[model samples]
Target: MKGKLKKTVVLVGMMGAGKTAVGNALARLLEVPFLDSDDEIERAANMTVAEIFARDGEPFFRARESEVLSRLLAGSPCILSTGGGAFLAPDNRVVIEEKGVAVWLKADLDLLWQRVRHKTTRPLLRTADPKATLAGLFDARQPVYALAGITVESKPDYSIEDMARKVMAALSGRHDVMEME
Candidate 1:
């Protein structure tokens, strides 16, 4: 259980991959605090994530994400859910790997599409062909997601609580492979 070993568990994955939900449930199970990078950035900038992307662009948002990551990591033993692109940054990946345990919440292409289908607020997904865009994004991010210390495969029917329990069990060494049923 890198969470127990490292004193923190950081969730990293693609958008709509359940980082926030799983982080919250994992935090509750572990009796720790949960922090979401998007929420933190919103608080810091006084704007929604979509607004930040629209008004300031992604570079600005990435900068804000880095700042929040720094602050969150400084406060050890917290359960943190990072933005989809956050871990793609080399420094961010290094920080999460060194300072905390990174758990990648992965879902199949169809499942991911289903989870995010209703969202028009996702700046990246606001395209003529969102499904194709999502597929491309998933392909591009798979390797980055794989670098996490643990991988949790998300099911459409499973609640965050179910995933959290599996994560807890995995971290506790009761399960191997870090893949949730």
Candidate 2:
């Protein structure tokens, strides 16, 4: 079934919460465009997220991220997947609240670690104890993510499509954001 996306759907969560994967699936299911803020940042800077972090530092990258988010949110509504740290910033959160519906893809720490551990792409997990670092980030970010407009629990056994369906179900109740036919 297809539905109208009245506002952009912004997926926010820790790195390995399947924001990109599930956002892609959700966009396909809803017949809307799918945009990734990190990809936009990388494209504009001609650098990967890790490279941006390594060279320009996080504050610089974050500034670029907020700029990209503002640009995207000002455009047509779509499914926007953000970097792990994007939603933690108050300004970004305010922009999202005004232009999009934020959905926290809440996943347990163990599940997040399992998905992100083998991925060397995550700059934040490059620490000596990556698992512990991930746990720390999870602890610190959960409260901030809880401020999202909606929460979709992501379980270890759930496939990307399942998570997307769950997100759709969560959005179904918000008539201002979604309309099912």
Candidate 3:
């Protein structure tokens, strides 16, 4: 019951879960344009994400996220890396599911923490114990991510490039043809 196979690839995951990195690699591998939702928001807002969070708040940011996602879907043959919370929004999830191949980049809590700790401006992870914070975020968001057609478990031993290749392979019918690449 899937729609027509557009060449667009949408990557979803938590912040610092490497969506941008992996999406870039995947875009290069597929030779498509790579679009990062956060970057698009920054461009449209004329401010950094930290500035947006400090001045406008999360609801505002999410609204911008939805706007950017919609515009991205209007195009074709592209790879998009969405904000960590994009899929949490029902409307955004529906748009992505209908328009493109949604791939969830899954990572363990520890790896997520290690990747994100150096970042000081994650509004959600500003808690005193970010480890517990990340675990809670993961618990809350994992089910939403599961709605994606593809789930890629990322680990230290495997590079994002590796996962991107796997995604391509899966999409090319080397894996489950019934599933999205």
lDDT of each candidate versus the true structure: 0.83, 0.95, 0.81
Worst 10 residues of 2 by lDDT: 1-10
Put down candidate 3 lDDT per residue, 119-155, tens digits, no spaces. Answer: 9878888789988888999999999899988887888
The predicted structure with the larger TM-score, 2 or 3, is 2
Kindly give the number of clashing pairs for every candidate: 1, 0, 0
Candidate 3 CA-lDDT value: 0.81
Report clash pairs, candidate 2.
none
Query: Order of candidates by TM-score, top first?
Result: 2, 1, 3
TM-score of 3: 0.89
RMSD of each: 3.9, 0.7, 4.0
Instruction: Return the candidate ranking by lDDT, descending.
Output: 2, 1, 3
Predicted candidate 1 versus true structure: per-residue lDDT over 1-181, tens digit per residue: 4334345688888889988888898888776789899999999889999999999999999988988898798885788999889999988988877777788888889998988999887889988999999999999999988998888788989988898877776577523322223
lDDT of 3 at 105: 86
